[model samples]
Target chain A: SAVISQKPSRDICQRGTSLTIQCQVDSQVTMMFWYRQQPGQSLTLIATANQGSEATYESGFVIDKFPISRPNLTFSTLTVSNMSPEDSSIYLCSVVGTGPLAGYYNEQFFGPGTRLTVL
Target chain B: SQQGEEDPQALSIQEGENATMNCSYKTSINNLQWYRQNSGRGLVHLILIRSNEREKHSGRLRVTLDTSKKSSSLLITASRAADTASYFCATQNQGGSEKLVFGKGTKLTVNP
Candidate 1:
């Protein structure tokens, strides 16, 4: 199992403001992803944080709204730009561990998550 | 393009009893996985069952996959209060992106 942590555990931002959440992994990982969980909803994949390249966003999400950067194997950042009340959700960072179980299961390990409340 | 759907949106049970959650997905998948979330926090991966495998077990957690039915089920034996959480099932498509598509999830409340 991999240990992951996120900055700004919880934050309250005004509408139109932007906030960037940082994710750090204890070990180098090849696949890192960003996800959004709205109130009373399931997790939605926002984008795939690719190292040294633009993130691969899912449908209904764009770089303009959610910009992500994976500078290295152990770190990534996601910026919520021009935030709105609808964007108020729990943002999570996830990565596939390089443990012995990796061969048996490609399960993902997630950060604690950043809870953003846009007022 | 939601791929998975979990039924019985919520469940309540007494401790020591067993709890079951079912999930169905559309399209062919390489593997199906179950995840648990406490409150609104990050999810914890519980177990994964590949398309080729019919069943898998990790401790007290049991997962079964039926590719012919495009559905899967998760069973927790002797549930405990600490097991109260939202359970979600995710599907990894046969090809393309390695992303896991999550379902709505079933909120399980194991009362002590």
Candidate 2:
């Protein structure tokens, strides 16, 4: 299992301001992804962060609003730009762990989410 | 639209009893995973059941998958108060390499 950590566990930001959340993994991982979970809702993948390439954003999410940085295999950052109340959600990062083994299922380990509250 | 949907939004069970939560997903999936979330914090991966495998177990957790019906279930036997948390089901969609679609999750309350 990999130990993952996020910075600024919880923050309250202004509606027009921006906040950046950082995710760091203990070991090098092949895949790192960003997800958002609104109050009482399920998780929605924001994007897949590539180590050296522009992130592949999911529909309705753009690079301008959610700029992601994958500097290395073990580190990634997600910044919520021009934030609004709707952008207030728990931002989580997950990485694929050792798997697809005997059971042929790859597991993902998530970091303690950075909760952003837009006021 | 979301891919997987969990049933019985909330459930309350007595300690030492069994708790079951079901998830239904649309579309072909390569694998289905169950995760536990404490409060609104990070999610802990519980168990994963492959598309070909019908069931898998880990400790007190048992997960069953039915590719034919696009549904999966998680059963926690003799659950305790520490087991009280939100359980989520995530699916790795077929044709989609690493994208995981997560369902709304079921809140399970185990009372002492």
Candidate 3:
């Protein structure tokens, strides 16, 4: 299993400000993704953070709002731009496990998550 | 417009009892996965059942898939208070970039 960690476990930012959440994995991973979980709602994919390339965003989400960067296999970052109360949610980074343990299911390992509160 | 939908939005059970949650999806899938989240935290993968397979088990978790009905169920035996959390079902489409469509979760509360 891969150990994933995210920076600034929780933060409060003013509207119109941007905060970058960092994710670091203990080992190399094949695929990295970003997701957002709103209060009392299910998780939604924000984008696929590809290594050394632009991210692939899901519907209703765009590069201008959620910019992602994956410089290497072990690290990635997600920046939530133009903060608003609606944007306040839990941001998580996940990686596809490639080792023997996770091969059967291709299970995803998730970081602790960054709880953002936009005021 | 979510791909998956879970039934019985919330469930409360006594410890040592069994808990069952059902999920239904719309399209052909490569696999169905079960995940658990506690107190609005990151999810933990519980188990995965492939499209071709009917059932899979892990520890206290049992997952069954019925492709004909486009549904799946997760059964947890001997539930514990620590097992209280929200459970979500995710589907991976037959052909895609490994993205998962999640369902509205079933929140389980086990009373000790």
* Per-candidate iRMSD: 1.1, 0.9, 1.3
- DockQ: the better of candidates 1 and 3: 1
Best of the two (2, 3) by TM-score? 3
Question: Model 2 over residues A12-111: C-alpha lDDT tens digits?
Answer: 9998999999999887878899999999898999999999999999998999999999999889999999999999899999888443212335777789
Error of 3 at A27 (Å): 1.0
lDDT minimum window of 10 residues, candidate 2 chain A:
A97-106
What is the two-chain DockQ of model 2?
0.82
**Candidate 1, overall lDDT?**
0.91
Model 1: how far residue A65 lies from native, Å: 1.1
Candidate 3: RMSD to truth: 1.2
**For candidate 3, what is the interface RMSD?**
1.3
lDDT of 1 by residue, B1-112 (tens): 5688898899999999999999999999988889999999888888888889999999999999999999999999999999999999998898866788899999999999
Q: Over the full model, what C-alpha lDDT does candidate 3 score relative to the true structure?
A: 0.91
**If the candidates were sorted by their DockQ against the true structure, best first, what order would they fall in?**
2, 1, 3
Across A10-108, the per-residue lDDT of candidate 1 in tens digits comes to: 999999999999999988887899999999999899999999999999999999999999999899999999999999999999887565325456777
Off by over 4 Å in 1: A99-103
Q: If ranked by TM-score, best first, what sequence of candidates would result?
A: 3, 1, 2
Docking class of 1: medium
DockQ of 3: 0.72
| Candidate 2 lDDT score at position B109 | 98
